[model samples]
Target chain A: MSRIEGRFKQLAMQGRTVLIPYIVAGDPAQDVTVPLMHQLVESGADMIELGVAFSDPMAEGPVIQLAHERALASHTSLSSVLTMVQVFRETDATTPVLLMGYANPVMHMGYAAFADAAGAAGVDGLITVDIPPEEVDGINSELQRVGIDNIFLVAPTTPEERIAQIAARASGFIYYVSLKGVTGAGNLDTKEVASRLKLIRKHSDLPVAVGFGIKDAASAAAVATVADGVVVGSALVDTLAQAFAGGGDQAVALGSAGKLLKQIHQGIANAAS
Target chain B: MTRNTEENIFATVPDEQGRYGVYGGKYVSETLMAALAELESVYRMLSVDPDFQRQLDEDLTHYVGRPSPLYEASRWSDNIGGARIFLKREDLNHTGAHKINNTIGQALLAKHMGKKRVIAETGAGQHGVATATIAARLGLECLVFMGEEDIRRQALNVYRMKLLGAEVIPVTSGSRTLTDAMNEAMRDWVTNVDDTFYCIGTVAGPHPYPLLVRDFQCVIGREARAQSLNQVGRLPDALVACVGGGSNAIGLFHPFLEDSEVAMYGVEAGGHGISTDQHAAPLTAGSPGVLHGNRTYLMQDSDGQIMETHSVSAGLDYPGVGPEHSWLKDLGRVNYVVADDDEALRAFHTLTRVEGIMPALETSHALAYAETLAAQMTPQQMIIVNLSGRGDKDIHTVAEIDGIEF
Candidate 1:
C-alpha cells in the first residue's frame, strides 16, 4: 500500500484522527526543513505536507503567499524541497511526506521526470494546486506508475457529480476546502463542513481531509470530528512568519511551528474520531 | 508550413475542452473548475439564445454605439503614396474606446444570470472605465483591479472609472502592471464566485472567457467585413490590428479567417526590441508556455517565470498573447509582427496630423505597421486598420515623453 493509505489505515485501526501539518520547505533557511519535518512527526503529525515554493501561488491567501515569497527568496526550489524530503526519509520511512504546490514547476520539470525524481526523493504523495481531477489523468498515471498518491481537492462550490468524480480518481484523501475562498482568506463554517463531509462520504470510502480555514486548536478539533484528517497550513505558516519577524532564528521558528502542531494534534486527539 | 490543414483550421476549434490547438485549457485551481464549467454551460446556452442575442444586440446598437464607422483615411493614404488605408473607428464607441463592446455584452449576461456585481482588470484603465460605465448602467456593483503603476500612468481614466462609481483597486504585486491586475482579479473572482461575475477585458484567460469575449468583440470584424465590401467596392486586401490579450485583433480577424484572400497582421508592442529583452512581442520572440489559465506564447524566462514586459502603450504591456492568436500564429493564418515604442509614437503623431484622428498608443502600433505595409502595396489595393481606441487616455504619457508640461 502507499504510505498515505497505510498511515490512514493504521490511524483507522487506532481510532485516531490524522493530523497533516503543512510547511513550505526551506522557508527560514534551507538546512532547517529536514529537522522541522522530523520535529513535526515527533509532535504527532500523522503525515506532513512539504510545500515547494512557486513564484505565483494563486490558490494560497496572504499568509501562505508570504511564506512562499520567503521560501523563494531563499532559493528553495522544487528540487530543494525534494532534497529536504530525501533527507527526512533517511531517518523515518513510515511517516508520509507529500509535496504540494502549483503545476508550473512540475510542467517545467516534465511530468514523467518529476514523478521519477519525486519518487526517488521519497515523496509519498503530491497535490498540484492548479490541476483539477479532469486535467490530472496524465500526471496521475505517471505518479501512480511510481507509487505516488495523487491527492485532489474538492471545493465548497463543487457539485455532487464532481465530488463523486474527484473521490473516484483521488488516491490519498479528499482535501475538502472548508470555505469558498482561497486558503487562509476566510473563516470555516464547521456546521457547513460537517454537512458537506456527509455528502462526500456518500460517494466514496476515501478519507476526507478538511482544510483552508482551520485557524486554531478549537477549529481544528471541530473539523477533526467530521474529517479523517485535518490540515493546518496557513496557521502554522503564520506562526512561523511571526517567529521569524520577532527576530527568532530558524530554530525558534521551527520550534514554534512544532509547538503549534503539537497543540493542534492534541486538539484533534481530544476530538471524537 | 502546412497549408493543407486549412479545411479543419477554424472548423474544430476548442474541441469541447476550450483548446485552440493545445493552446488553451482551464489551467486554474480546483476552486475555479466548477465555476468555469458552470460558465461554459451558461455561455453555450445563452450565446445561441434568441432573447440573449436580442438583448445584447439592442445594447450594442443603442447603448454601445455599434456599427462604428469604417472611414477611409484619404489624406493619410495620399500622403503615404500607396495603398488606400481605411480605419475601423472603434475609438468612436461609447466610453471612447473599443472596450465598451465586450463590457456591455458581459454586463447584460451578468444581469441575466442574476449576478449583482462585476469585476474587471485593466492596465490603461480604458477597460475598467468601460466596465464601470456598463455596471453603473446595469445597476451592478463594480470593482476594477489596475496595477499601481498603471493607475499612476493613466490617472485620468482612473478618475473616470471612479466617477462611474466603480471601486478601483490598485494591485501592488509583481511588476505592478496589467498581468498583476489580472492575477488580483482572478483571485477576487475565486474568492467571491457566488455573487460577482468576472468581466474579463481581453480574449485571453481560460475557456468560456476567450470564447465569450471573442464572440462579443467579433462584432467589430463582422461589421468591418460588410463595410469594406460596401465602401471599398471589394474586400480589403489586408487587415491589421494591435494585439495585447488579442481581443480586438481576434474580433477583427475571426470574420476574415476563412477569407483566404484577406491577409491579416497582428502588431505586438516591441517596447525596445525583441532582441533586447524589453519587448512585449510574445508571438514574435517567445516560446509556448501556460500562464493565467491558458497555454499560450509568453515572454517568460528560462525558469518559466513570466518576464517583465515593456511597452509605451499600457494596454499592450503584457507578457502573454491570447491562445487563439497563438493557434493562428502556428497555423500561419495571421502574421504576428511588432512596432517599437518610437514607431508607435510616430504613427500616433502621423495619424493626428494627417487623418485628424488621435489613435491610442496600442492602436498606433497597428497604424505604424499599416504605414509600412500600405507603403509597399499599390494604390488600387486597400488596407483596413482597426483604430482600437481613442488616444485621449495616452495624451499625458505622450506629453511627458516629449518633455512638455500640461
Candidate 2:
C-alpha cells in the first residue's frame, strides 16, 4: 500500500479523522521549510500537502496568492521544492507528503522525469489543481509507474458524470472543495459538504477530504465529522505568513505555526469519527 | 462570407476536443470543466439555431457596422513601390476595434444562457469597453479585470468602460499586465461559475473560448475575401495582422487557410528586440509551453515560470500567443515575424501621413511588416493588412513618447 493509503488505514483503525496541513515549500524562507515540516508532524499533522509555487495561482484567493508570491520571491522552483521534500523526508519516513500546485511547473519538468524525481524525493501523492482527469492521462500514468498516488479535486459544481470519471482515475483521497469559490474564501456550509460527500461516496470508495474554508478548530471539527480527512490550506498559510512577517526568528514563526496546527489537530482528535 | 468546404484540410481543425494539433485543451481546474462543457453544448446548439444566427447577423450589420470598408492605400503602396496594398478597416467598427465582434457574440451567449452577469479581462481596455458596451445594451451586469499598470496607461479607455457602467477591478499581481488580469478574471469565473459568463476577449483561454472567439471574429476574413475578389479582381497575394493573443490575426487568416496560394504573416511585438529578453514575440523567440489554460508558444524562463513581457502596445504585451497560432507556426502555414517598438511607431506615422489614417500601435506592428513584405513583392501583387483598431486610444501613448504633455 502507498504511504497515504497506509496512513488512512491506520487512522481509520484508531477511529480518528486525518488532519492534512498545507504549507508552501519556500514560503517565508527556504531554510525554515524542513524544520517546519518536522514541527507540523510533531504537532500531530497526519499528512502534509506541500504547495509548489507557480507564477500564476488562479485557484487561490488573496491569502494563498500572497503566499505563492512570497514563495516565488524566494526563487523557489519545482526542483528546489523537490529538494525541500527530500530534506524533510530524512527523519520522517512514515508521514505522507503530497505535493499540491498547478500543472505548468510539473509540465516544465517532463512528466516521466518529474515523477521520477518526486518519487525519489519521497512524495507520496500529487494534487495538480488545474489538470482534471480528462487532461491528466500523460502525467497520471507516469506517476502511477512510480507508485505515486494521483489525487483529484471534486468541486461542488462537478457533475456526477465527472465525479465517476475522477473517481476512476483517482488514488489516495478525494479533495472536495467545500466552497464554490477559491481557497481562503469563507462560509464552510458543512451541511452542503455532507451532502456532496454522500454523492462522491457513491462514485468512489476512496476517502473524501474536505478543504477550502476550514479556518479554526470549530470549523475543522465540523468537517472532521463528515470527511475522512480535513485539509487546512489558506488558513494555515495565512497564520504562517503573519507569523513570519511579524518575525523574531525562524523559531518564533515555527512555534506560532505549530500552535495553530496543534489546536486544529486536537479538534479533529476530539471530534466524533 | 462562405466557409471553406469540409474537404479543405485546414477547415476542420481544433477537432471536437478543441485540440489544434496538440496545442489547445481545457487545461483548467475541475471547477471549470462542467461550465466549459455546458458552454460548448449551448454554443454548439445556438450556432446552428436560426433565430440565434439571425439575431447575431442583424446585430453585426446594424450595431457593429459590418462590411467595414476595404480601402486601397495607393499612396502608401506607391511609397513602398513594390506591391499594391489594401487596408481592411476593422478600426471603423463600433467601439473602435475588432474586439467588439467577439464581445457581442459572447454577450448574446450570456443572454441566451440566462446569465445575468458577464466578466471580461483586458489590457488595452478596448475589450473592456467593448464588453461594457454590450453589457449595457443587454442589461447584464458587467465586470472588467484590468492590470493596475494597464489602467494607468490606458486611462481614457478605462474611463470609457466606467461610463458604460462596468466595474473595473485592477489586478495587482504578477508583473501587473494582461496575463495577470486574465489570471484574476479566471479566479472570478471559478468563484461565480453558476451565474456569471466569462466573455473571453481573444482566441486564447481554454477549449470552447478559442473556438468560439475565432468563429465570431472570422467575419473579418470572410468579408475581406469577398472584397478582395470584387475590388482587386482576385485574392490578395498575402495577408498580414498583429498577433498578441492572436484573435485578429486568426480572424483574418482562418477563412484563407485553404487558399494555398495566399500567404499569411503574424507580426509579434519585438519590444526592444527578441535578443534582449524584453520582447513579447512568443512565436518568434519562445518555446512551446502551457500557459493561460492552453498549450501554446510562451515567453517563459527556464523554470517554466512565465516571464514579464514588454511592448509599446499594451494589447501585444503578453507572454503567450493563442494555441491556434502555435499550431499554425508548427505547421508552417503562417510566417511569424517581429516588429520592434521603433518599427511599429514608424509605421504608425507612415500610415497616418501617407494614407490619412492613423492605426493603433498593435495594428501598426502589422503595417510595419506589410511595408517590408510589400517592398519585396512586385507592384502587380497585392497585400491586405488588418487595421485591427484605431489610433484614438493610442494618442496619449504617442504623446508621452514624444515628450509632449497635454
Candidate 3:
C-alpha cells in the first residue's frame, strides 16, 4: 500500500482521526523547513503536508499566499521541496509527506522528472491544487506509477456525480474544503461539512480529510467528527509567519505552534474518547 | 500569404471535456470544476432555448444598440489609397464598446441561471463598465476587479463603472494589470459560487468560458457578415481585429472560420517592439504554457513564471490570448500580427484627424494593422476592421503622452 493509504488505514483501525499540519517548505528560511517538518511530527501530526511554493497560488487565501511569497523569496523551488522531504525521511520513515501547491512548478519540472525525483525523495503524495481530475492525463498516471498518491479536492459545491468521478482516481484521502471560499477566509460550518462528507463517502472508500476553513482546535475537533483526517493550513502558516516576522524568536514561535497543534490533537482525541 | 486549409474542425472542437486539440481544458483548482460543469450545462440548455435567445435579442436591439453599423470609411480609405476599408462600428454600441455585447449576453444568462450577483475583471474598465451597466439594468449586484495600475490609467472608466453601481475593487497583486484582475476575479468566483456569476471579459479561462464568450460576442461577426453582404457585392477580402484575451477578435473570426476565401489578421499589442522584452504579443514572442486556467500561448519564462507584459493600452497588456486563438495559430488559419505602441499611436491620431473618429487604443491596434495591410492591397478589395471600442476613456492617457493636462 502507498504510505498515505497505509497511514489512513492504521488511523482507521485505531479509531483516531489523522492530524495533517501544512507548512510551506522554506518559508521564512530554507533551513527552517526540514526542522519544521520534524517539529510537526513531534507535535502529533499523522502526516506532513509540505507546500511547494509557486509564483501564483489561486486556491490560497492571504495567509497561505503570504507563506508562498516568503518561501519563493527564499528561492525555494520544486527540487528544494523534494530535498526537504529527503532530509525529513532520514529520521522519520513512517509519516507520509504530501507535497501541496499549484501545478505550474511541477509542470515546469516535467511530470516524469518530478515523479521520479519525488519518489526518490520519499515523498508520499501530491496535492496539485490547480489540476482537476478531468485534466489529469500527463501527471496522474506518472505520479501513480512511482507510488505517489494524487490527492484531489472535493468542495461543498461538488455534485454527487463529479464526486464519484473524482473519487475514482483520488488517493491518500480527499481534501474536503469545509467552506465555499479560499483558505482562512471565514469560519467553518461543521454541520454543512458533515453533510458533504456523507456524499463523498458514498463514492469512495478513501479517507476524507477536511480543510480550508478549520481555524483552531475547536474547528479542527469539530471537523474530526465526520472526517477521517483534519487539515489546518492557514492557521499554522499564520503561526509560522508571526514567528518569521519577529513576533517572537524561532524556538518560541515553533514551540507555540507545536503547543497549538498539541491542543488540536488532544481535542480530536478527547472527542473520540 | 500561403497557408494550409483550416480543416473544418471548428464543429468538432472542445470535445466532451472542453479541449481544443489538447489546448483548452479544466486546468483550474478542483473547487471550480463543479461550477464550470454547472455553467456548461446551463449554457448548453440556454444555447438553443428560444426564450433565452428572444430575451437576448430584445436586449441587444433595444438596450445595447446591436446591429452596430458597418460604416464604409470612405475618407480614411481615400487617405490610405489602398483597399476600401469598412469599420464594424462596435464603438457605436451602448457604453462605447463591444464589451457590452458579451456583458449583456452573460448578464441575461446570469438572470436565466438565477444568479443574484455578477463579478468581472477589467484592465481598460470597458468590460467592467459594460458588466455593471447590465447588472444595474437587471437589478443584480455587480463587482469589478481592476488592477491598481489600470484604475489609475483608466480613472474615467473607473468613475463610469462606479456610477453604474459596480464596486470597483483595486487588485494589488503581481504586475497589477488585467492578468492580476483576472486572478482576483477567479478567487471571488471560487469564494462566492453560490450567488456570484463571473462575467469574464474575454475568451480565456477554463472550458466553457472561451466558448461561451465567443458565442456571445459573435453577434459582431453575424451582423458584420450580413451587413457586408448587403453593402458590398461579396465578402470582404480581409478582416482585421485587435486581440487581448482575444474576445473581440474571436467574436469576429469564429463565424468566418469556414469562409476560406476571407483572410483574417489578429493584432497583438507590441508595447515597444518584438525584439525588446517589453511587448505583450504572446503569439509572436512567447510559447505555449498554461495560465489563467487554460493551456495557451503565454508570456512565461523557462521556469513557468509568467513574465510581466507591457502595452501602451491597458486593455492589450495581457500576456496571454484565448485558447482557441492558440489552436488557430497552430493550424495556420488566422494570421496573427503585432502593432507597436508607436504604430498604434500613429493609427490612433491618423483616424482621429483624417476621419474625425477617435478610436480606443485597443481598437487602434487593429486600425494600425489594417492601415498597413490596406496600403498594399488594391482599392477593388475590401477589409473590415472590428473597431472594438471608443477612445473617450483613453483621452487622458493620450493627453498625458502629448504633454497636455486637463
Error of 2 at A249 (Å): 1.0
Which pairs in model 1 have colliding backbones?
A: none
Tens-place lDDT per residue, model 1, B134-246, is 99998899999999999999999999999999999998877789998998898899999999899999988888789989989999999999998787678888999999999
User: Once superposed on the true structure, which residue ranges of model 2 sit more than 4 Å away at CA?
Assistant: B1-7
Best by TM-score: 2
Could you tell me the lDDT of residue B123 within candidate 1?
A: 91
Docking band of candidate 2: high
- Using DockQ, rank the candidates from best to worst: 2, 3, 1
Provide the lDDT at B145 for model 1.
98
Distance from true location, Cα of A158 in model 1, Å? 0.9
lDDT of 2 by residue, B135-245 (tens): 999999999999999998999999999999999999999889899999999999999999999999999999999999999999999999999999878998999999999
Candidate 1 lDDT over A1-273, as tens digits, reads: 888988888998888888999889878678878888888898889999888877767777878877877887787878788888888889999899998888777877778988999999899999988888767887999998999999988888989999888888998888888887878878888889999999999998888888899888889999988788999999998898899899998778879988998888888888863
**Clash list (residue pairs), candidate 2:** none
**Comparison by DockQ, 1 against 2, better one:** 2
Model 3: per-residue Cα lDDT over B1-406, one tens digit each: 2222755677788788888886887788777887888889999999999999998999999998888999999999998899999999999999999999898888878898899999999999999999999999989999999999999999999999999988999988778899989988989999999889999989999989999999999999988888998889688899999999999999898888888889999999999998999999999888887788888898877666678899999999999889999999998989999999999999999999988889999999999999999999999999999999999999999999999988
Candidate with top DockQ is: 2
What local lDDT does model 2 show for residue A48? 94
Per-residue lDDT, model 1, residue B293, is: 88
